[model samples]
Target: MLTLACSWLGMQWVHEAGHVLGALATGGEVERVVLHPLSISRTDLRTNPRPLVVTWAGPAFGVLAPLILWGMARGFSLDSAYLFRFFAGFCCLANGAYIGLGSFDAVGDCGELLRNGAAMGELWLFGALSSASGLILWNGQGRHFGLGNNGQPVPFRHCAGLAAITVGLISAGNLFFGTG
Candidate 1:
């Protein structure tokens, strides 16, 4: 149980890091990165009129990190190594979705400068990336909706309960059903 908890925490760290690094690389300034068991809170620069490429980079990196880590872990393929990779992948996807979807708020706020009329390539890209991440999290943990784009404070108990239930189910399935 402890091992699983630690693994989940580690994965969450990596996931949040992915978002931070992506934002930094793309010239998006980070306001805060609040680490928690349930969610990672990040408030990035919304004032700048950044290029679509720059805006897209943060979430792109977030999605890519776990995939790369998972591939590396799979290469090792030792005892239960893949599970670690999966956890990391799930974290990356979830956090990536948050960053990607959350970018909309910024874009919407600076609509006059960044909107670019009807050309919505950046919007579509971010939305798609976030949606993909949400789907991955849903499949792995049965967590469907996150705190909305507003970044509301979700009760820690609720988030912890969901995570606990997910871990329990995964463990039980592995033990009784002999499936990993």
Candidate 2:
């Protein structure tokens, strides 16, 4: 459990760090990188027209650490391998969900940049998907876990709903394909 927790945390760090690196690469200055117990945020210069690129960079950046860890996990014992794979899969899914959801802000931010003569189509799509999925999840979850947002204790019903969905997906997958 400790290993799983550590792996989760490590993956999150790498994912968030990717956003920071992307911001820097695209001529945007990172204002602050805040690491809290439950989450991290890389606040950057809002004035930069390349916010979409920076936002897209975050999820892309996050994939690196998990892939590296997945490679390392392959050489481990069976039990450890299972744990590592689970961790890797969870990280990938969670990060993908996050990127897809959080990028909604990119549309508005990118629009502003576009007005200033910066054009980016791919970034726009990434941002739109992220934002749309994020909004849907937020609505369903009954809370907002978004950039600059703080953690809140989720309601029990909400937790249960999420668990049921996860279990249902796993059960359906196993029943149909004999695999998770």
- lDDT against the true structure, per candidate, is 0.49, 0.50
Task: Give Cα distance to truth, residue 139, candidate 1, Å.
Answer: 8.2
| Candidate 2 residue lDDT tens string, 1-180 | 333345455554566577677777877776655443344433445445476566555666565566566668676643334334444555565565554443355333344345445445544554455444434433422222222355444445544644554455445434532321
* lDDT digits (tens) for residues 71-168 of candidate 1: 67668874334344545545655544554455566443124215544244554565566566545644533222233444334346545754775676
User: Which sections of candidate 1 miss by over 4 Å?
Assistant: 1-12, 22-31, 38-40, 43-55, 92-180
User: By summed lDDT, which 10 consecutive residues of candidate 1 come out lowest?
Assistant: 140-149
Top-scoring candidate (TM-score):
2
If candidate 1 were superposed on the true structure by all CA atoms, what would the RMSD be? 13.4
- Assess the local accuracy of residue 77 in candidate 1 as a C-alpha lDDT between 0 and 100: 75
lDDT leader: 2
User: Total clashes, candidate 2?
Assistant: 5
RMSD to the hidden true structure, all candidates: 13.4, 15.2
Q: Supply the global lDDT for candidate 1.
A: 0.49
